[model samples]
Target: MSENARVTKAAGVVGAATFLSRIFGFVRDVVIAWFFGAGLSSDAFFVAFRIPNLLRRLFAEGSLSIAFIPVFTEYLTHHGKEEAFHLARSAMRLLSIILVITAVLGVLLAPLIILMIAPGFTDSPEKYSLTVLLTRIMFPYIFFICLVALCMGILNVLGHFAAPALAPVCLNIAIIFSAFFISPYMADPVTGLAIGVLIGGALQLTLQLPFLIRKGFYFWEKAVIFHPGVKKIGILMLPAIFGASVYQLNILVGTLLASLLPEGSVSYLYYADRLVQFPLGIFAIATATAVLPSLSRQAAAKDFDALGNTFAHAMKLVFFITVPSMAGLI
Candidate 1:
């Protein structure tokens, strides 16, 4: 298949998967709203979810995947699969250590984080405590989701899109199930949502594993502590984190401000943001995800012309789809 056709087809797969995920996500939101309403519980849950979700966007999906893909693709193109797989293992090891530390710290610092992000919650001691508890429960989600992001980068480089694209659907379904089946039994019903986040994250990671192993990317091997490709990914990730997460930072700021508003303000903004993310995820993100491996390979081969063409094609496709979606939303 031609490069353009390959990218277009991959995008279609990812977009379709993302569309399904978004639909389930909407249903998840509805279930939460039906049970919790836009009150203290809902607001607390949203704020709790937002902290880890922001980190997932900023570090996992935004930085790690973006930085890991090109480097991993380059390893595959020039150095061969064995060496590339070595780098993948090394990256996973380092990421696991870092994520473990981060999750631990996040749990310990949940109160301080909640204070910084939603100071107004302090006005209601109950809300503040609940948010802190929920935040701690969901903080570990960052660990699982980031690993899933690394798996996504590897799989996408290996020409697999469906599993990673379908990952979010697992999260949505998990949350919906928890809302219905688990929340009723919980002492604090909203606590179930936090547990769902962790379960969803684990399911996302689990879904990628069999596909990865089938492609000969197993996790059982000992990892190099200082692989060169891992170093390069780290270097690339610093800039990528800031570059890709400016919008997320804006949302974080919005979340902080929303905390100062009425009781339901945070939940209101969360729902609205979900509506906007639906189209963006299905089109813009899918196109970028599909194009990355191709662009990376072309660049690795020093095929500048092909790289430029692929980039241009992706940009045009994103605009063609997203502009109309944007207009409709407006």
Candidate 2:
């Protein structure tokens, strides 16, 4: 096939798979609404769940993937694949250590964080306690999800996009099953959903292991977070953190405003935003997933012309679709 033909074919596959995943995800949400409905628990869980989910996007997928993958890919392309592998190992260690510490801290501070995020929860001891417990269970999800993102970065660099795109379906499937069969048996639906969240993350991470092993990048050794390449990741991540913080703060402001409106304000926003999210998730992410490694390749060769060309093409593609979609939403 010609280069354009190959690229087009690859994109079609990714887009098709992404569409299926989103369809399943929509079904899962529909099931959740049928089971949970719009109520205090649903509202609280959605808001509470939003916190970690937002962080997962910002830290795992958005910031970390965008920043870390480019650097990691650069190492792989230029310094030799072994050096790139070393960077991965080092990142694994650093991420493990940091996530462990942060998850623990998050668990410990879950009540405080919940209280601060939604002060209304404090008035109901039952809701407050349950939210704290659920948050604690789900906080470790960031670690799994972020590690999955790292694996995805590796896969992306290797010209593999389908597996990473498909990984999320596991989570949605797990939640859907749990919500239907297992949730009623649990203490409550919210508890079941939280458990499903954790299990889904495990499933997501596990799906990547076989692929990584096949690629000879599945060894389990501790990363020296201070390793040279990992340090570069850290350096890039600083700005990434600030950028994510600003974005999250904007969402927080929106949430706060939504909270002031009425009982279902947050829930309405959640559903509405989910629709907005669906296309962006499929298009932007699939494009980014497919293109990052290519751009990294050009960067590795210090071929700014190629990089610029790819960037322009990708931007045009993103804008052409996203602008009209946004206009539709407006």
Best by lDDT: 1
For every model shown, what is its TM-score relative to the native structure? 0.99, 0.93
lDDT of 2 by residue, 179-280 (tens): 977889987667888888889999999999898877878457544568887777778878887887887887777765665555656677777778988888
* Per-residue alpha-carbon lDDT of candidate 1 for residues 151-221, written as tens digits (9 for 90 to 100): 99999999999999999999999999999888999999999989999999999999999999999998998
Candidate 2 displacement at residue 250 in angstroms:
1.9
Score candidate 1 by lDDT: 0.94
Cα lDDT, model 2, residue 282: 75
| Candidate 1 Cα misplacement greater than 4 A, ranges | none
Top-TM-score candidate index? 1
* Candidate 1 residue pairs that clash: none
